[model samples]
Target: MFNIDKNKVKHANLFAAGLALGTVGLKVLTSKDAKKVYANVVAAGIRAKDSIMQTAEKVQASSGSILADAQEINEKRRQDEALFEEEESDEK
Candidate 1:
């Protein structure tokens, strides 16, 4: 815990005033420069998004192939199990 005197409140006000002044000065001096930097950032973001979409499509294709192969393997296993059960029943 911390304790402070009410009379010391002037320092807080002074700090706020300095922060506001600095913010206004930065906006006035760098507005144009900030715009150019932001434009480049947006363009790069767009390119990254396109690449992500392409990668997702390739992943989807590969997943589909893997799923199909698994289903085929499962069907063959089921058929083999059925044949094994039939032979056991005949011997009994």
Candidate 2:
């Protein structure tokens, strides 16, 4: 007493068969092309990453230089202020 609908079962089987055949055919047809496309994509990604890394390094170096220059200016200002205060005290 299997309460299965015969038509529905037939339709399901046909769908499964078609899907399997299509997948196999596509893989056979495009495996080589897929590999080549994948390689190209990987190469492009590597190049993009390398370029970004170089730009980041350049930005870091420039920021360091800017910070060093600011520190030098601050130190010079401090020294000048100290000398001026000393001169005023001597006058008094």
Candidate No. with top lDDT: 2
Q: RMSD per prediction, one decimal? A: 6.3, 3.9
At residue 31, candidate 2 shows an lDDT of: 92
Model 1 clash pairs? Answer: none
* lDDT tens digits, residue span 26-78, model 2: 89768998889889999999999999999999999999999999999999999
Best by TM-score: 1
Model 1 bad stretches (over 4 Å): 1-30
Which runs of model 2 end up more than 4 angstroms from their true locations? 5-30
> How do the predictions measure up, each by TM-score?
0.71, 0.68
Error of 1 at 90 (Å): 1.3
Output the lDDT of residue 37, model 1: 88
Every candidate's lDDT: 0.94, 0.97
Query: TM-score of predicted model 2?
Result: 0.68
- Candidate 1, 1-92: lDDT as tens digits: 77977667888988899999999988976899888988999999999999999999999999999999999999999999999999999999
